[model samples]
Target: MSPRNSLLLVLGMASALLAQGPDLPIDPANSFKVNLPGDGPLALVSADWGRSSATARGGAMLVDLHSTLVFKNSSPRPIRGVSLLVLAQEVTPGGKASVTVPSLDIQSGESFPIRVDLRLMRPLNAGSGALVQVGLDGVLFEDLTFYGPNRLNARREMLAWELSARRDRKAMLSTLLQAGPEGLRRQLLSVLARPADNLVMGMQVARALPPTNIDPGRVVEFAFLQFPDSPVELLSGEARMTGTEARAPRIEIQSKSKRPIRFVELGWLARDEQGREFMAGTLPADLSLPPGAHSTIRRENTLRFAKPVNGLTAYPSAVEYADGELWVPAYSSLKDPRLAAALPASGEERRLAQLYRRKGLEAVVQELRALR
Candidate 1:
């Protein structure tokens, strides 16, 4: 039997079994099925697929999914968190239509439900019931360890790329320093003219933008609006804007937690007294504030925007902290999705992916491994 027919037969059997239970109202035959490897401590209890709709998006069929997955901890160890990347691989290869289900905790032998509400774009002729194969990808532990097949191997690939990119950056900086201004300008132009083979090189070339002479007297004036209510209080600070540039000097902050903060992202917003608002962007500052310590940080941001602004009131709308393991949003705070969309992918990532498409994974690995 073809895989599609086998899946249909299995769906029929599962449907009959599910129909026997009073709580299972969903029809299994109509629902897309997902199969997970059975070697893990967490076991799939039941998956109730919800309604699906199809539409056209950019010459492809976009499938909107609404489903829930129930996983029970079958092992003795309590699970504090589970991060999963639910992928509809058969419908869209390379797992383009995947969603990272937010982390959730499940106690030993207890079942927890994860709701999926994401879109999947597939070939127009793939058909609605073309045996949509689903794969669960990503790490399964609090310490961020992988237990399943790394189909994408995104983690390792990114790690290798980042390590290599850092080395390339250091090398470029040393070379540029030794070359001086005229040589640096020539090298920058040459790198920019070449095809983007490496993101590190591209970024290094981009950062060599000719320094702008700011008119100190004509710099757009800005007032210190109230800082977002956060654990880190802004004790003293001032910011000035000058044509896509924002300079924050003498910024002081106090950390209330015992854990040292490694980084902070303060989202910028401009507001008027009449209630008009604009998402200015984000001011990301790296810091080393020891436990319950006070620290000062400086930021120089080249804000990208085309809108005219009257810096009547400018302040941070959100905050995030990297307490060691990971960067978490501040208490009762969430990142504005619009801001995230505006940000560009890391230079190394774009260049490496392009390299992969042009040269292949072997070439990518060779280049990465060759990095000192």
Candidate 2:
């Protein structure tokens, strides 16, 4: 063959070889992965399962879930006949039961939206609520082949569990607090201090803290007063300081747990320059914090739209806007000396002042846009 032709032949052979090489194994762990529409998978994405007002009807416990299932298909192939399974477990001690939608199809490269209308035929036998487990179980192929739980989709399921757990915990805490301080404490002790065979409930209880005792000019911190196995630690005694405006102010907390600790919720009572008291929720935007190390939970000037404006200001007076109504901390009161020292000095207080000066409504909207 001519030299040029020979070179061409060799290149052709190399290209063929590359094409024929074995395909990389799909991560066994991700074999069940399914990508939904929207930002990503529906399994792990946070969703609200819309609420239903329950009224006793005879002996049956009646609850309905009127929520949309947003499915995004990132795959090249069209998806047809998707099955979604929702497990509704009684909150009290009992066996679990579920509902299933066997076949729903979606076009390839398209988003499929489904509204799940669920009715709980049997009320939770014992507990005040029920645990709802929603998942995508099967995807049907055109050729009659079946795909089980997609690992990616399974991840979405895990995320759903997390989101549900968080919401439930919040509801539980809110109910407890509504019963008043003593009621809150009783609920905490019963839920947290008690031992349970249900891992989910235990985990939820593990994150619950006692309500704060709000006092003017105080910063109260609650450590893992009970759970030694807790995945978090309280590094420094909670310190309170005043006068944080320009610079970001933070509290240094040391952790002994191996798992990462995200500040899911933070409660505090403070007074603004006007001497107006308020209850505040101080958890940062990005909730995740490292574990087995010292970390700082800082107060930034940025406002979050998702957080309500009720709790942002200190009690008696509303400074800025309330993000959410503040709750009392678990152990110490707002007047505790330890709490008072935790407040920031003047320079550190600028962020909050700026937020209020700009007006909370506009500032929060801008902050939300920045997140996008």
Candidate 3:
């Protein structure tokens, strides 16, 4: 048999041996031990899938997940079939529970990928919120490691995505700078950074604006240049507890901007005992823009804290808040100057360049939190 198949057989035998008595529900509190090839312990990481409405593709709304598991061997022996218990909550409070997996397998000193497809078994009748949980199960012979949407994993993921996005942005900017005029370059940058939802609106505005005495090229350039350095900057803002509501208390944030901004993001800065600043929550809302000349855009966001107080994992980072607060980032200007400069000029360089200019590490956490 092939090495992979051989490993699978070994794992199946191991799982059967580990399966004793009635299969108890996986415990969320316990840690799964990973045995490596050599000595020491294995590390496991898990990320929850971000919940997205899959109604368009599937008849019912479904939750899709992609998790990466990494196993490092400390000894010479190989390992496989590392069973893991995942915690999932219903979208509605007190929802039903079920588990489904398309496929699962692993190799020693190697990584494996797992996907979970979840669908709502029944309609949520009544509930304030949803509940999900994940835990560890099974055994690892040597040192095993896993990474996913959890706090640490999310941070690492976001940082990687951010680097990619920045690289892409730089490469695109470079190309536009070489081929287009100053105005066009600016416009390209703007469109690249504009929120996905706002792109159409911004385009509509560009079309409506009378070129008048302006050159058509320049007008096009102006429209393109209107994109921002980044979506939803905190020009000057602060968060405050405004009032109490019947459902949840309200927290308000007010901010002013120099340009005709598309949206405003209100982020809460909180730190643990270690003084590490983690994002609390983000509120994204549309800002009213006045006609003619520059204007200050003012906006507010309201958040109601949950009773019994959810833990830190409940909060989202700023990048996630921006996405949740408004629209997805526009993939435009994959051809702009700032983006181009940061990326390779050609070939596989283009593909590699596109990978790094996405978003930051915290954004992944926020997306996962939203799923929760």
Clashing pairs in 1: none
Q: Which candidate number has the best lDDT?
A: 1
Regions of candidate 2 where Cα sits further than 4 Å from its true position: 1-51, 56-60, 90-105, 122-130, 149-372
| Top-TM-score structure, candidate number | 1
TM-score of each: 0.38, 0.24, 0.23
Candidate number with the higher lDDT (1 or 3): 1
Candidate 3 deviant stretches above 4 angstroms: 1-116, 121-259, 266-268, 291-372
Quick one: how many clashes does candidate 1 have?
Answer: 0
Deviation from native of the Cα of residue 180 in model 2, angstroms: 76
* lDDT of all predictions: 0.49, 0.38, 0.31
Tens digits of per-residue lDDT, candidate 3, 322-372, equal: 222222223443334433232223221333222333553233223323422
Model 3, residue 147: C-alpha shift (Å): 33
TM-score pick, better of 1 and 3: 1
Quote the positional error of residue 45 for candidate 1 in Å. Answer: 1.7
Candidates ranked by TM-score: 1, 2, 3
Off by over 4 Å in 1: 1-37, 56-58, 88-105, 125-134, 137-264, 268-270, 274-324, 327-372
lDDT of 2 by residue, 67-119 (tens): 66566655555454455655444342222323333223445556666666666
**Superposition-based RMSD of candidate 2 using all C-alpha atoms, in angstroms:** 24.1
